[model samples]
Target: MERFVNWSGSLAFDAERLRQPTSEQEVIDIVHEALDRGGSVRPVGSGHSSTPLAETGDTLISFGRMAGLVGADKSNGRATLLPGTGLAEAGSALAEHGLAMENLGDVDYQSLAGAMGTGTHGTGRELGNLSSTLVGGTLVTGTGAVVRFGEQADSAQGQTLLRAAQLALGALGVLTSLTLRVQPAFDLHRQNWMTHIDWVLGHFEELSQTCRHVDFYWYPRSDRAQVRVLTLPGDEPAISPPGYLKKDERGPSYEVIPNFRDLKFDEMEYMLPLEHGLEAFRRVRERVKDRHRDKVGWRVLVRTVAPDDAMLSNIRQPTMTIALLQNASLDHEPYFRDMEALFLDWGGRPHWGKKHYRTAPDLRRMYPDWDAFLTLREKCDPEGVFLNDYLTEIFGLQGAP
Candidate 1:
């Protein structure tokens, strides 16, 4: 058996075989063989997801060999990228063509397909998650058929399929290529500072609304927080209190948007209604201070994401996300589960790729188009060739091959 482990060293599993395919035909062939043998095929991309979405005891397909920019259209500001291409690599490639991703998460090591599939996002009141940038893509369905959505779609049904494919959690099929809406290469000015949590909570609304991007990390041990904001050059600088400025710099959008994460940690993030975000954070803070402060050595992250139309998107409406992170070497279950209860009371939805304790029934109630996505998944992969034990349970599927 071949062993696989995630970036954070949290989830690990063994597979019967691991196959790396360099072409679309090879992916189709792999699926066909899995179907013939009545086995399962799970796709792995950087293994950045802390969840068991990629766990499997059967065949594992890796797209690392089939990476890089496939094509670019400067006139349309669009680019087609191989699914395995890392966000950092894609950014540099797109820059060469005078293009860039509109927004990106603080971590850029995830593959394009992995980020899209998991609804990864950055902080901004107006910017949707990375999946929202997907305009089209091609996937090898369970039946060994090539399906195209987005720009290639010519009808209403095709467009609907495209929306479902936008964030299918790798349950629909294996993505071979993705077409994204890019923009002319641009630059941004980033500023970071440390402040009291009370001040951040009081002024967060003003900061988020006036800045292009804003996020913060609140330490449990100390009530203090570190706030970071990004703005396009020449934009009015965000209002700040005296002596809070720690670092100020300007660089290309790609370089400035992401922070370098050197420490590994386990994380559980939930998206809640913007209206209830502050109160939820207050309650979480109280609980952490009252109970879990001794065990929590990492900070809590708060960010916002704009609403999007993807069927399974976490942000159906404007959302505020609160993430609980702990050192990878420490046990995270007790603290995460305790915080999760608070999030659920506030109508929270889990980030698909992160650690969560929700089942199909719990998730179905959270997403408005849950049934619609399931129907599409069935149409695309009726045989369930892509579902492993973890996906099978969450999707509420009956037997796995």
Candidate 2:
């Protein structure tokens, strides 16, 4: 039976079997079973990734059985969570301990593991992506061997393995649990205003530096920009939200950071160097006006993330991610492809879990650590038990037919 589909319903697969393992031992056993059967396995979380990263031709594994807070390190401000733990749930748990994940994207539906695995990030010029906070991880490898990374391993290979695994996209193994660096719970003062596209560009650098979290949402068809900024509460008082925005809100950092995502859409996000971001936006604006204005109503979200060294992370440079959105009910390929071309011309890197047109060869040139990641993948999952068609294609493995 076909047991699953993604949130956007754009990607789906009929796995020969579906397994939700409640324990790490079960995960290890499933890997062994897939190996024994000469079939590959793919791990699925909340199915938040629009790309087919988790789609598999054989066995599909979901970590829902292992959901929720597993443990916490009060002294060091860390939390070890089962991969299936929902972001919002983890946020609430962290709050109880006077802590929270350092940053978060607007939508909180993704599992913690999925977020960390795919380089998911919040908008903060000084803050890094989710993978950047990974202090340790435990996973069952393709060889059916359980390995602990981060603090557990004491060699250069182990450290390199941690860097690769932080944003691995499941090519290496099935992550059972992860330890993340957290911070004390704090309040934020958020403000929203509707402004012109030109104004946002004119003050891009200044605003980005001043605000802890800021993003610009522009509807290309309409040519209007909604400027949103979040900062620590200060001597200033709350103000009314601008007419174009939902509302100005303030609360716990995690609670205030994510907006309710009721509108479903397929997305393609590309990380461009800060210097090229505005230029790319201008080009996309011209192209949208000249070619595909009618197809877009969903806003283009542009946000920032500081650099990090997770091998597959697109946040390797202080960058801005331009996320193009399309209503899930409509065809998106042509529009996304056009934007992909624009991004590529700007030397941008695609977000691993989002829609994109890059394969192994194209990606290798974009990522300096691409070959290194492939080497690690080979050593960890030599038999390809952890690979799916998408992983196979990206990592240059022989995809299972």
lDDT of 2 by residue, 1-401 (tens): 65578998898778888898999999989988988888888888888899998887688888888987778877888888889999999999888888899999878989988888888988989999988999887878999888888865777777888999899998889888888899888899787778678777887677888889889898886677888889898723233332465457889987899988887899999999987888888888898889889878587899999999988888888898899989999889999998799899888999988999998889888889988988888888888887776777876766543
Report the poorest 10 consecutive residues by lDDT, candidate 2. Answer: 235-244
For candidate 1, write residues 1-401 as lDDT tens digits: 88999999999899999999989999999999998988889988899899999888999888899899999998998999999999999999999999999999989999999999999999999999999999988988998999888887777877898889899889999889999999999999998888889989988898999999999999999899988989998884647754378779999999889888999999999999998998999999999999999999899999999999999998999999999999999999999998999999999999999999999899888888999998888888888898877887887876644
Which ten residues in a row are the worst by lDDT in model 1?
A: 235-244
Task: Give the Cα error of residue 4 in candidate 1, in Å.
Answer: 0.5
**Residue pairs in steric clash, candidate 1?**
none
Report the C-alpha displacement of residue 263, candidate 2, in angstroms: 1.6
Evaluate residue 141 in candidate 1 and report its C-alpha lDDT on the 0 to 100 scale.
91
Per-prediction backbone clash count: 0, 0
lDDT of each: 0.91, 0.85
Candidate 1 has what TM-score? 0.98
Query: Candidate 1 regions off by >4 Å?
Result: 236-238
